[model samples]
Target: MSVTASQVHGAVQTLTQSSDTLFLLLGAIMVFLMHAGFAFLEVGTVRHKNQVNALVKILADFGISALAYFFIGYWVAYGANFFADAQTLSQGNGYELVKFFFLLTFAAAIPAIVSGGIAERARFYPILVATFFTVGLVYPVFEGMIWNGNFGLQAWFESQFGYGFHDFAGSVVVHGVGGWIALVAVLFLGMRKGRIRAGKHTNFAPSNIPFLALGAWILCVGWFGFNVMSAQTLNGISGLVAMNSLMAMVGGIVAALIAGKNDPGFIHNGPLAGLVAICAGSDLMHPIGSLITGAVAGALFVYLFTYLQNKTKIDDVLGVWPLHGVCGAWGGIAAGIFGQTALGGLGGVSFVVQLLGTLVGIGIAVGGALVVYGIINKVSGLRLSEEDEFNGADLAIHKISATSDD
Candidate 1:
């Protein structure tokens, strides 16, 4: 039997759809692996006694976040839900399912980012509650506004300025929101025990450098999927995104190495700071521009992490505010700058629009985090007791340590 043109066309389309679905599925798996990075990063940063709590929290938060996003967050963001029959749900080669899985990884990251800031002292269940509210409501609201164009905010930006706010990926939306929210929770939770005494600061050393390095490496590798896969379809993918991500990562590392004075923690976190900054404009900016953006983000993380921890007395354990929050914001604004035609970029971004969108993201994250965490704090309490603090969160909450001695 001979194949007709119609049959050939149909087969080609099916092949394309299957390929796209597979690509996104791989991306989802890669992003999902970043949670392990989040877990081990927290594990290596906190004291040995609290290591188990850090590990447990990331996994637990991912579980709760999946449910929260499935039931409410996905709907709030895109007005889509899994309420349809299985047949309908599986349409488009189950593209929607894999898409949800991919985006759910991003949604779960909000709580993962917060977990780092509030680690070693936070109550597991209460933080999980906050994560549900944040993933289900707070994050999706802004996500819908920006990515889905739900609220006409992007339209307003385009009308008021030139082009609308452009976050190809989610520098401001994911990292920035998570960071600002984590900052608020950190402030509300107050200093960790013995971190501050007589208005001075005490340093806390990381428990495991190897684990920290491994976590950073995992995140660094996974971030390519995070940034590039945001295109969501094969035709939309670009080598520009890949190159820009690479430039930004090295830029962050180089700057962090210099600014951090060769500190292992800062060096490991440098690539992350750069990648966070580059996510917004990865497709638009030239590699050199991305390098500058990443470099700035790296320096910003180093300086702000130090200032916030020491001078300001904010005990943001993993420096999420600097790495994700501030650097993410910088990434947002940098997109407008480095993405301009004059700056060797693809253009079509307005600096003012970028700033406004970034500010909106910051405001919503801070406000929503305060309300959610604040209520949780007032009602059920957010922190472990001082006794728990002394005994370590692992022993206090989980009844075990990372290692057992007979």
Candidate 2:
């Protein structure tokens, strides 16, 4: 018996769809593991008394984020819903389901980012409610404008600038948005107790360097999947994306090492700064361009994190604003610079459009976070009582510490 042309065609189509699904599923899993990285990073950064709260918040936020995204967020971003029966929903080999899984991980990151900034003092239930609103509505609105071309924003950019805003893998959409929102929440929550005395700031050393380093490592390893898998199809995979990501990582590390004067925390977070900056242009820039972008991001993170914490007296525990907000914004704008043909890049982006889009993202993120967090703060109060703060969030909120002996 010979294989018929129609059978061969059908088999090929099935194989292609199956392969794509598998690829996205793996990508989603890797991105999902980054949440563990987020948790451990916060655990290591905050005081030991607050360690368990960090862990719990990340996990809980993810659960709430999943619910919010499933019922509301996904629809806002992509105009798709899961209200259909299983068979109808499972069309496209259930690629849409896995796609939701992947994107939900990204959506959940907003609260994970805020968790770091507000850690050790935030009220658990209020923050969870804020997370629900952010994931369900705020994030997806901006996400739709950029990724889904909602509201003619992209069209306006293209019409005005001759090229539309181009964020290949969501520098502005995910990291930038998360970072800015975190900043707003941090501002609203105010400084932790005793962090400022006599108009001077105090340093709260990380509880565990090993844990922080471990989290950074996990995030670094998983970022490859995060960037590469944004393609969402096997045929779309690019070695350039992988190489750019590598170069950016090292660039950030080296720059952070120099800028931070060999501080262990900065050294560990350097690669993350680079990865965050390179995320937008990973597919378009030359490796050298990526390195430069990463280096800039590393220096920016070190400088801004220091200034924000000490001089400005903002108590952003994990420096999420510098790492994600600033660096991610840089990634969005850098996509236009390094992605220019003049700079050995693919050259389909416009700097004006990038700037405009980045500004829009920042505005929406800050505004939305302020509104959501402000309402929650007013209604339920966002912070722990001073007694609870001194006692630590782990014991106060969860009735347990990270270690049983504690």
Candidate 3:
């Protein structure tokens, strides 16, 4: 016999709430593990001397992001300002608190991505300073204004397109910030000493493959949370988001293999690039769209990494631009191409809107990151001395070395 209508309703509610809570919690844990990935990946990408420094920076920056988010970052980025007329902060639990927690993790992760680009050659103290500025001040303000509907891009996204913009998982917000920061750091730090000196190529090999591979894998796993949890509610949509994520990873891997690199480092960029590519439209895309996005991102990442490393002379040690920035741009545009209002209303999965939103986000993130880092560079100095860099940041700044003593 069929259940009564009331009974059916009750069962549905219970199932949805329980599943939502479980998935969100699981996603949070997965996202947290991404920090480990960053630690291993960044450390492995740098020289042996800077291994400890790379790990330390990742850990410390996370700490700083947590603190900053708790204090001001949360309020600025995801506070109850946008839907001011529509909602209010109750006693304890509300969207305000929920959004804060969700966005804080993302804001923190952005700076972590940049840590690798400046590895081996940036001062320890400067790392702390940069993290503070990036997480505490820069990222929060930009993200809050745009997506949170508090101050910046909300009206633009809404008025110009007749539909608000949607990131699904912060392609423009988190990755864009990190990419821009990496750009600034590299420009300020300049090329590694021998990389440019006397025109001799001093290949910087990863110190530990385990660390690098582990980091890359962890990042891929954690990305499920990074993309899915952004929904703030889990339903069938969670499955779609997760599916897109997987497809994108496959695409990235294929692209990496096609790029044909002797080094694993080049190949590793594929997964990251794919993740970044699908971020904007994960919830909106068909399975095929996700697959294509990931594939393109993976291939683009390898090519971009090679070009930046050999041709452009910008030493993005962790390949932030290709993985986050370039793929982020792709994600944004893909959102425009694939996004549809039928998929997720008001958010207007429209491709045109997505393209405009992507450009806007890029312009602001790139320009703002450049300015903030430039100012920091002018003040305390962003790069370690040539001697310090050659010796290793861990030894120069932290007084510890990964290498064994004789």
Q: Best-fitting candidate, measured by lDDT?
A: 1
- Mind giving the per-residue lDDT tens digits that candidate 3 earns over 1-406? 9889999998887777666656555666677788898899987778788888888888888888888777767766655333344345422224344545566678878778888787777877766777877787777776776676766466776777676667778777778667876787778787877676567445667778878888898898888888878776664456888888898888888878778464687677687888988887888887677888888888887887778887877888888877888788888787776565454322355567777777777776667677777787788888888888888788888888887798
Q: Lowest lDDT 10-mer window, candidate 3?
A: 86-95
N/CA/C clash count, model 2: 0
Q: Count the backbone clashes (under 3 Å) in each candidate.
A: 0, 0, 6
In order of appearance, the predictions have TM-scores of 0.99, 0.99, 0.87
lDDT value for model 2: 0.94
RMSD of 3: 4.6
Which regions in candidate 1 have their CA more than 4 angstroms from the true location?
Answer: none
lDDT values, one for every candidate: 0.95, 0.94, 0.76
lDDT of 1 by residue, 57-111 (tens): 9999999999999999999999999988999999889999999999999999999
**TM-score: model 1 vs. ground truth:** 0.99
CA error at residue 64 for candidate 1, angstroms: 0.4
